[model samples]
Target: MDEFEKSSIEGRVIELADSSRREVEQEANEAKAEQQRYIAELLKNSSKTPIVVSAVLTSDHQSIRPDVLQKYLDATILQASSFSQLCEQADLLNVKLIQHGMAENVSQSLDSRGILRLPVIKRHYPSLVYESQAISGELAVIDVISRLNILPIKRFTAKTGTNIGNGEGDGYLQFQLRNMFGGGEQLKLDITKGTKTHSSYLLDYGQPVTPWWMLNSMLFKNSRQFGNNNSIDMLIRGFRTSLRSGFQEAGAINHELFYEAEWRTSKLLSLHASDTLLFQAGDDIKSSLGHTLAVDRRNNPIAPTSGSFLKITNELALGKYWKSQVEFSQNNSWLKDDFIGSCCTFRSGYIANLNSSKKTVNTYDKFHNGGANDIRSFQIMGLGPKDLYDSIGGDAFISYGVSLFSRLPIKKWSHSNFRLHWFFNGGKLINHNNAPLKSVVTQLANQHSTSVGFGILLRHQVARFELNFTLPLTVHSGDAMRKGFQYGIGVSFL
Candidate 1:
């Protein structure tokens, strides 16, 4: 062989070996990087995958006892697919949690084994410092919440707002305090004071709707002015105070049940005349234990365009008199073209006095129908019964109100909150005492009051105002009928 050929072959063989070695080293490095990524992802959901390790909950300065949390969580935490799944389990398991107690996903921290440390998961809970208070059972966590500094025991707040209406304009001041402690248990106190210019029994019409002739005439004081028409105005002032406490009964996805104790007292500070006209009134002190169930799936509470709302409250007053009241209301709506929202509200209530107390249920509380907040066809409390010039109210009452809303005809105001609604109302109030059974059932139903009306529903962010004109189709003899136009302005609708 020639010397030049032999030298060239050896150099080519060396170059080939170097090239192969470089390729092998690069492949090994890439494989290692890929394996680390796989290991990291596997750690993220190790509890859900083939790995089945019991969740070890840990905390910082917060003293969280795993033994207590696991008692309520049972074995669900072991099977949770991810941190989010674990949180879902915690929410449903009747455990106490701080305001922003769960936010661990953002911190991609790791332990010695490159696995997510349970302590880092718990660090997401920033506000709470947990302590064990109960001596026995899983419910001991509730005791921990009582001593939690994250939630305060009491807070006082006051609000002053303009209370405007079709016939009355007034300002109100209300003070409230709500205390939250110990596993959703709560205590609330409320005080309200307001003044209004009102008509007979706080139902009928008042100025400035009252014509000038009726106000200036000498007969204004003596004529049936207050009765025939609610033109004679009277200044009224009242103060009310209420206290409520509730124990956590149960909580589900969108519903909650509260077992509550309620005490309420109201005093009429001043009134115009207490003679034969404003006859039936006295002090009332009512104490009640009740269960209130609220299920809210509404898309919007301000102006619900869709979804549903249900509230059922049943109370029993236990004392010298055993009086019970049950109230149920359902609100539902549908939006057409995502803008035209139509809604219907159905509410029915019943009250009965079981004992023979001089201060019967009728003496203090009655079903007052027909108002912007209720039927909207007549004046407040003007639909059912009348005791001479006053609406004395009734024991058992049922009302059905259905309303339909659509865009205004004007193009410029088509999407504005100032819109139009048509409604139909039908209901009856029954006083079972001194009344025929047939009348309470079917006979009065023949005279069941019904009215159809149209109104302007002016909606704002905080309130709703309405102007209505109603025509009664079926009016009973005693019903304070509104023959022509009726005006109502309030925050809610029938």
Candidate 2:
């Protein structure tokens, strides 16, 4: 059996029968009638015989040709052969080294229910063709894959952005649509204009677990001086539509179920003084029904390095307000393949103002914390319960943060995603005038507060920029005291 050991055992028997096929998903006339009954039973008893062909490249590389491939083979062209009975008659015609790209277009799967349009994915798989050619290999290609699964790529889109903060200036516009009538349903539109110089809105509620948009664009040049009320002007409009399905997926974490309908309208490019006492009393309309149950086994969402990300979001709005959110984060490696590690984040949530527990809980959905990303040195929501310096958000809340990342021992910033850590952040946001979670976990240990710091986490490209200089070292004097430097911000590390 020499001819390179019969072409390496007929290319390892068409790679163990395409890795034991069956990832179930076929229909473009059942994958063109199973590639025409497996090439008509491999040319039913030697139809014009001479078989000895080979090709490769599809372990993510994808591509195969071997010259027009005898238009789908009935057999002829011959060259060299130690033919081990043509690899046992191409393994009883179950051969499938699939990978054809409609002239470099792109796609080999991702049709899902729209009915197989499979085409793209082919770059380099055309070598070893000893005896191959003679054609009649009959290929209808499922009526050209059923006219490429009804090819219509619907459309709509608009987007705009201009933002500058600190002194204040913001602008935004957006619109989107996707496969609307073809089952993939999606639509979105948004408009916004903004300016604010913090006249109490809990300094715009700080980090309840990261994402304050660069301290809201890192304070856009700090611009606070407009007029009546003192500088906070804004307008917003939104619309949402979404559809995604596929859950369980036979294991190894990849679940999804997102269905949403939202309409929001918030206006106040006028009134201020933190909207007097809730909207100063004007326009408000919110209608919502949302659900998100996401569990992703993250390897690197920007710079995670390891895995674990959990999300549980629930929003229900019929009359005025309802909120539910729980996010979990995890990361590892204290030198497993040595990339420096340790990370755990837990974000809790709550928002209840179903009209009267005396009416509140909507500063566009209140949840606040100290700045730079959940209590780094306090100031945004400035650590709860206060009415003079503002931050009056509470209806039941809890936040927690844990960090221990390292590897800036300086080796030219030791392989990026930059780090250096030591952190502990505990939280409690309350105003549950009807306490009881064991008296809110015993007034959450004196309305809980914790801080221990040493920071520097630059890593951008999806966010995480911090510069903390904390020191609240267990205090009790009326709480809200953020001694020195604090400008933290984090994102999606969940």
Candidate 3:
């Protein structure tokens, strides 16, 4: 009786185990089939048709990254179910992206025949890092494409000249050129020239601001003109005029020929170098052709010259936020006849969000009396005349500083924003020789000066203009000995 019961129990247990295994296998098979069907549906509907995306960026008086908004558009287009769905998807994405008073303007423009014109995407965003990077990347891409097509832009320059001492008033000219590829390469050129003159007096005391005033202006003589791309830039200038009594006698003939070429390894970095040779012969050639060497801290020539200069410049950006540059020159009049004066500058800045910013700066000191052409400004200006042998003192200097800049818009003028910046700059001018005892005492007691200043920057974007005035709050005791109020209209670059 016991053997028979045990066998029955074992058979029942085996039956239950087999049934459980079968149920699990069936469920796994069903799940696999469902996944296969879903993937098949995605593949069957996939088409080779190109996807077009449009985006509009707007901020309610706030700045955002346009590239980030553009990325949202790209993601929607890539995952869209259909062309119409893609457009609708873009519209929906815009609504989800508004932040901090920003807005987007998106719409479709259509033609009379119902054909799509261009989709318009406008956004109001203050300049942001990502947007800047995106734009820089896009520009790099365009430059690459242009190079591949042999239509790379070669050079851009704007220059103005005036006859200061005695001449036909003031003459001005502006020119620009862009190179593109056609059957052969083509160059687009714009040239302008003009002249004018005016005079005024201060009303307070009826004092004359100037004994006489005159201006000659030059407007673009021609627009939309094209020339051979490979042709060298040729410029010819000549003027003849007489000076009245009380004015210095001046007459001049001058000409210049310049050539430039550019090469780019990537978007973030580029190299541009140009060579310009000029020649002039006249009674008062000071205004036409002359050279001077830069003086070192000790008033020695780093770059001495009076006639011609040969310059080479290299610009490199290590990444999106860092950049450096090196410049070399020869035969510059500012260089001392025996010394070569060269300079190097490195600058970098990064955005730590839309609000915070950081920057680094370093500049090499100038080597005085170190070039082939050694001419001194003090002598030229009639302050002192010393030969190179007698005026042989100079040394280089180094400056390192950091700055933090932030955007804070004014409520009254929302469109014209402002930036608040605080910077600490310190550097030294290395003298060729140690200071004399008296000079050292003078410097320690307030004979030499180091300056520190801080001020606000009023920036108007529409006009691309900036007005900055810094007040030196901290100055060495020596600085006060020679210091007067220092004021300027723009940044040092201008």
- TM-score attained by model 2: 0.26
Candidates in order have lDDT scores of 0.48, 0.49, 0.27
- The model with the greatest TM-score is 1
List residue ranges in candidate 2 displaced over 4 A: 1-131, 134-290, 299-305, 308-312, 324-334, 337-339, 344-358, 361-383, 386-402, 405-422, 426-450, 453-494
**Model 1: lDDT to the true structure:** 0.48
Q: Give each prediction's root-mean-square deviation over alpha carbons.
A: 18.5, 23.1, 28.3
Model 2: lDDT of residue 288? 69
TM-score of each: 0.53, 0.26, 0.25
Model 2 over residues 1-494: C-alpha lDDT tens digits?
Answer: 59999999999998877765633434456888989999777646434332223321222221223333223222311121213333333331112111111121212211112222222232111232346575322321111110111123334657788655223456766665543342223345444456553221111111101110111100111223222333333333333333333222122343233323333333344434443333433445566676667776766566676787887777777765677878788888766345567778888776655775555655445666655566555555666665433455665667777777777776786877767777777777777654445775566556477777777777787677766667766644345667666655556421
lDDT of 2: 0.49
Count of steric clashes across candidates, in order: 0, 17, 64
Which 10-residue window of candidate 1 scores lowest in summed lDDT?
Answer: 210-219
